[model samples]
Target: MRHDSATLIILLAVVALIAWFAPDVVLIVFAGCLLAVALRAPGVPLARRLGIAEHWGVMIVALVALVALGLLVWFGFATLADQAREFSRAVPRVLERAGTLLEGLPGGDWLKGQAQPEAVQPSARAAANFALAGVSGTLGALGNALLVLLLGLYIGADPTLYRRGALALLSPGLRPRGEATLNAMAHSLRGWLLGQMFGMAFTGVFTFLGLWALGVPLAALLAILTAIFGFMPYIGPVIGAVPAVLIAASHDTSLVPWVIALFFASQNIEGNFLTPMVQKQSSDVPPALLLGAQALFGTGLGFLGILLAAPIAAAGMAALRVSYVEGWVEDPADTDEKRIIRPA
Candidate 1:
């Protein structure tokens, strides 16, 4: 018993060490899993329709998506870059104005002081180093993007390979149940990816149109941010809307209310209409549970954790219900079958 206990403790320590040191790799793999689901979701239907292999169908769909994305970037990247640059320059002025406006409120003086930039000047060498670091970071991001793409392709091409390997970790008796749990988890993730994709697109399109109609600056950039962050539930939309509201407030205080109203309406539609319609087939998780998971994982794993928090929570909840709660924890104490089979 002591030997078994020691082995269990050592195994847990190893797992903890890996989690602490390799959060990024874990997140990257998670991204690959999500991409695989996204690819497989449409690929399976296309394969059936075209009488082609599922893998081939996935490749074709991926290629089409890549082409569409390339064309979009080609046409829109220049405008986005310009707007991003303008927004960066405008940020300081906007902050200053915000500080002034809040001067009458509590902590307003401290806030204004914090917003006021220090008079310290950096050397040209320091500026050069900053620029070099920015370039390095951009290149690193590109590298990570390529890695994620390759991982996704490999995983999506033969998902069963990985699934089989995962199931192998279980004892023979538990393997069947493990496989079932994995299938359920896959369904949950696939449903999530579908709902999330629709939500992001819906949020982006409506936000762009509404902001443009309101003549808001940086509307396109803001819309893109909104769409990307829309994947995160509850807190994401609020974070996405803040910049647009700030920009509006800087331009004209009156426009602030209009910008807020637009976001409010969009969120209402998303919460009431789009989410329900899309998530109907998806796994259901409580909002508070999801929020708690987000907070915990986000603190430990940063942005990637926050991005995938809901799916993780849903999957975990499903597994616990299936394998733990239903299987043993809540098993009936006295059953008719058991009583009848007892010794006379």
Candidate 2:
């Protein structure tokens, strides 16, 4: 109906407005939705096992999950702290060597005279500030973290409420189809998240092992960083590897090729083998479409926009397929039983 189409457009407009006007809050909501779904998978059986009320089970499960996450964060921070200390000790020597090497180049004398001293000072100060900012930005992230945790807790307690609430907004007769559509959406999202998580973990492990074999320092920190990047759709592997390669390059030029090969190889394995095997829930969307969505979302919103764009678009697609194409204009020749996903 025209009314439903208008409503869909309005809903999308509202979502886009929120994303544009309040990206940080939108990010928290996105993270909350994902974390809630993650907890939902393990919450059901445990709830029944403990004979607790569903809400109480949510609290317990959420508590356990949050605690586990806190520990992981602590461990990762500890590793990063160690790496930072090592960097503080080693960076000066690395820079000095780099300067020496630069000074020894064939055109070094000419380049040195051409290099402006004031420009170098600002660049050095900017680099120092950037490093400090990396460790000092926790206060800003805390609010986002709390928002995600609270939202996850509330949603995990009553995910059905959200599904039903959303379905209720559809036309009365379309509610059943909406439910099925949402299930498909949930399946796709959960499967994608699971696949990415597994792939990221495997990539991180691969990074750590390879770096260790090549005598790279801060391998643990680098591995964790790689895992974070690998979760991102397109640009993650390259972003994660840049610093790793830079650090290795600083130590020894010969290590550059080895590090590059290892990083690319691990990601290739994940992309070719692990991802398809695990992420079988959602059929692959066209890469061009995916890239376009990412570009549009990134341009319209920000980093998290790029992150959630694909799934949000997929959910929209699923809903439209069910409501308009499949559910609305039923084929007259089809019997009720034969209708299924085709047309009724």
Q: Candidates' lDDT values, in order?
A: 0.80, 0.73
* Worst-scoring 10-residue span by lDDT in model 2: 335-344
Report lDDT (Cα) of residue 111, candidate 1.
81
On residues 211-323, what C-alpha lDDT tens digit does candidate 1 reach at each position?
Answer: 99999999999999999889898879999999999898888888988999999998889877887688784567888998999999899887778988888887777666555
lDDT of 2 by residue, 1-344 (tens): 67767766777698789867887777677779777767776676678889986767778788887799899878777778979799667655555445545687898766554443432444778888987886677766776778888898888788888877887777665566667667766666667777788899899999999999999888888898889877666667888998787678678879989999998899889977897688774535555776788788788777777777766665556655555566667652352533333210
Highest TM-score: give the candidate number: 1
Candidate 2 lDDT (Cα, 0 to 1): 0.73
Model 1 clashing residue pairs (backbone): none
TM-score of each: 0.87, 0.78
Q: In order, how many clashes per candidate?
A: 0, 0
Q: What is the overall TM-score of model 1 with all chains considered together?
A: 0.87
Q: After superposition, how far is residue 106 of candidate 1 from its true place, in Å?
A: 1.5
